[model samples]
Target: MSQRDLAKHLGVSLGGVNYCVKALIDIGWIKAGNFARNEDKRVYAYLLTPKGIAEKAALTARFLRRKMDEYDALKAEIEQLQAELAADGR
Candidate 1:
């Protein structure tokens, strides 16, 4: 998708997408190339680089681990609370 499409899909403003994409481009996470030309020659397409793929993989793992930790903590707390309530006969 183009940056416009990405912004709309992400429910953010175009400027937000531009800022984020620019940062990623600077870090070598994304590449912008000219795919086809219209009446103008300023259009370009963006794709993820190998570095970006690696970053995505690492981010996914980190996110999953954090989510699992949160889920486990919440679940254990709920169980403890249930047991306490049962013991109190309420």
Candidate 2:
């Protein structure tokens, strides 16, 4: 997606999107290519490198694990509250 589109989707400023994209390119996680066919010479496409794919997978795994931990904590809290209510004969 274009940086403007990305900024809108993320609810962030255009400058923030540009900064992040530049950082990603600098880190070799993604590569930016010019689209000369487009009427606008400023148009470019960002493609993920192989390393980027691996990094994304790792990040996904970490996010899922964190969510699961949160779910378990919430479930435990709910069970504790239920037990307290039962003991109080509510």
* Model 1 regions more than 4 Å off: 8-13, 37-43
Candidate 1 global TM-score: 0.76
Candidate 2, superposed: residue stretches over 4 Å from native: none
lDDT of 2 by residue, 54-74 (tens): 999999999999999999999
What TM-score do all the candidates reach, one by one? 0.76, 0.84
Candidate 1 global CA lDDT score: 0.91
Query: In model 1, what lDDT does residue 26 have?
Result: 100
Clashing pairs in 2: none
Task: Give the candidate number with the greatest TM-score.
Answer: 2
Per-residue lDDT of 11 in model 1: 100
Q: All candidates' lDDT scores?
A: 0.91, 0.95
